[model samples]
Target chain A: MATDLMSNGNRPSAEDIAARRKVIEVDRLDFAFGARQVLFDISLDVREGEIMVVMGGSGSGKTTLLRHLVGLMPPQPGKVKLLDKDMGALNRRQLLDLKRRIGVAFQFGALFSSLTVAENVKLPLRELTDLEERTMDIMANMKLEVCNLSGFGHLMPADLSGGMMKRASIARAIVMDPKLVFLDEPSSGLDPAVSSALDDLILKLRDAMDISVVVVSHDIESAFKIADRITILDKGRILISDRVDAVRNSPNERVQNLLHRRSEQIDVDPTEYLRRLAGD
Target chain B: MANPAKFFEQIGRRTASGLDEMGYATVLFFEAIYWTLTGWRQRQPVRIAATFAAMVEIGVAALPIATLLAATIGLMLAIQSLYSLGIFGAEQYAFIGIALSVVREFSPMIMGILIAGRSGSAIAARLATMNINQEIDALQVMGINPNRFLVAPVLIALVVMMPCLAMWANIVSILAAGLYVSAELNQSFGAYLNDTLDVLKVDDVWHGLGKAGLFGIIIALVGVVNGSMVKGGAEGVGRVTTRSVVLSVTLIVVADMIFAYLTTR
Candidate 1:
């Protein structure tokens, strides 16, 4: 199935994105785990009011990159700038202030099990603002309504299904009306209907709230459905980042392999295989 | 055979890692202290409700077991002390032996070990599970310091509760010993209690309570540090939980020894 960026025509081109403000910018980011390198010379940008999907197969460093964008892991030997603040240079107070401007929904719900769903949604507000408890409750209810989780607030996270948990997590992420939201694997481990609903929520969030979103996902269909721009990561490097049609029509073999769900068959030498089997 | 140099290298690595972890725990301990003092200044004051919740979990919930164990220990101490003092034909001083030992050392040590195994392991497991589930990360992303929001309340609760539990144990154990001694000597329980109180100075009780407080800090710091450093997944939670209890118990004993020596000297 082929989708056309040009025919849709309302989609912004690369030049159009350049004119918009960049909410998040990563420059030459490199990350490593002890002796092993996981992210290499990675550079990407999320513009204002755009849903940027970073897609890759397992272990492709998409989650690592998301962590950097959300300021969970400081970028080493590189830079990550969010809302025009250098993440690595910020002091404690400054870092907290910066964090308040963005929100992150982890892959799993990550709701505090001790708290009810509404309490989880209101936690950031409660921690960051001295608003009256009544006001905070109303605000939490509004966000929950926005995420289509209006009455489920009284239930514990353990009581919610996978999809409801993800929605509640998103509600919490956006409750503070953060300028940017980072969602990690929102559609993962959900039925297609639920995943589609999450995708619709992402779209609604961007269009209605005017918030930029960075989603780390390997789901090709959901990525294409909601992402204004897509960055394809393979083995710690960006293979291609472009409009959805450009990504779809790209000549890159790995991108095609991912899009087509084709697994690459690695050819092995018989002698090497036998020798390795024999513990040579 | 493993190379001799590799063995030394392994030892060196382990030593360095151990020191590194201790250093981290020290830093976190100080951070918890700082947050506990200034947490009220927060835009959203760290809720007293959390502290009370922790008190319930770390302190109130363990009351029954503490009572049962301390009573049994009191009986055992009385039986042993009476037999030893019987040879001198001074069974009348049996209350003094039981009271001094119970108030000065045994009560605090037992309370510490109990809390370390029960609450300390629980703290480590809860925090590790939070870490694994990314709830800790969620808090950080929400501009809340986990040290302030999570660790400080637990630290305060434990520091407050350990002494209370220890003091309660002291009373329970002394009373149990008094009952046994009164029954043995055909003396009134009230007379036995009076003699125990007269012999046991305020300083002795304070010394035990002080050790209990120190053990509280040890348990809190060790549990928080171990929980925060958890890696991987479910197995990591189990490992940290075990490590927290073991380390807290070990450090409590070590600290008790030092405190005993210094206070006595």
Candidate 2:
């Protein structure tokens, strides 16, 4: 009865996307690339001023789902409303306006290798605003400082370590102090320590800036450690979308297998198997 | 008990998505055009110097070699055509025929091919390197247009260089063809110059120059677009670099043929 009830509620309520001015609300999204469906009926919400981590295995539509949220890729089969506007329905002027309110740290850090860190930080400010040199510099310094990268402004992104580079990218993303920030695989190539430091920086940014944060990552430890809430996906369906602790303790076999790497999933434990067979 | 209405709604949503991507692609192309022009302010000196240097490299500096090739080809073709005409006792019209045909047809086509091979390859390689290094994405994330930053200078530079190159090729071919006829065929230099002048008009040369300018843009745009999209490891960059030159050349030839048909007719 509970399963039937849950399935019946899959349809988004009339007020679901239209209600609150959520930072992001994905309503029953179904996405496919021709015959290969990547996401199926994914319904979720990213509230204002909260850190929501969308975690899943590789090829589980983590990045694809994030792209839809950021307006880089339009939502398919349902609406992805960001800040109360459907991303798919925005006009050119409105889209630009909407994009200005968000920041994205792409999977690769996406820093312009040609420009120095200072110039990279200077980009959004220069293009979108009329701030004077000193003001822009001040803002750039503040963002860099937030990322713990103040003195190294003039250095190229190539000069930074993997962790530092990601921080710099994060700094660039938030230079606009956007209402929403999206990060795709923030800890992909970094060491554990560096990854933890990045998590600390993310938490610091969320609290300090008071902005909604959505991170798309496949790293299990990093996800569990930093995610306030975890949305686990398998085969394009949401296996679990709840608090990290609740999802951790859930009884769903698929969710359990994903979260707790299913030791009994294989043949038997070596010692137990040996003892039982030997006794026989 | 089934949401059959939901199924058709899904199809409509997919259709809308395809249209949105098409719209974004169009927007990106124009943004690239606008950005290339304004991106100059981002890195003023180096960007300006690099573009100016590309113009000099492609236009003024390559003039001598380009002229030599055009002239040599003109001489060989003129000689061969005159020999064939001489069999029908139309040998005396060699200067008129060669001057018109070479200046109007071959000059622009050769210039297009040369620019596509040299400048196009250089552009593709540079864009590929920029892409590999993440500079293009950097510009985009920064809200600065990479097209404005990278493509604009090359596009502007190519449009300027191509006409000048074609003119240089025209002059060189005419001079070499004149010398060849004067020394070997015992045709007077003054006679060769006058006959050629009578057959070739300002419009013919201008039309050919116009084609060269358009062809330059085609080649440069092709190089930049292909190069900017290069991804993965070194092999990916190499593959796109090769594709840039090949595609540019192919487009140039096809464009030239169409332009030639239109103008000559």
The prediction achieving the highest lDDT against the true structure is 1
Candidate 1 residue-wise lDDT, B1-265, digit = tens: 9899999999999999999989998888888888777766755455799999999998999999999989998999999988999999999999888998898899999999999999999999999999999999999889899988998889899889999999999999999988998899899999999999899999999999999999999999899889988998999999999999999999998999999999977
Error of 2 at A183 (Å): 0.9
Q: What lDDT tens digits, residue by residue, belong to model 2 across residues B155-196?
A: 778888998888888888888778877676788989888888
Identify the candidate with maximal TM-score. Answer: 1
Error of 1 at A101 (Å): 1.1
State the C-alpha lDDT per candidate.
0.90, 0.77
- The worst-scoring run of ten residues by lDDT in candidate 2 chain B lies at B37-46
Q: Candidate 1 chain B — worst ten consecutive residues by lDDT sum? A: B38-47
Candidate 2's error at B106, in angstroms?
A: 3.2
Reference-based TM-score of each model: 0.95, 0.76
Instruction: Give candidate 2's TM-score.
Output: 0.76
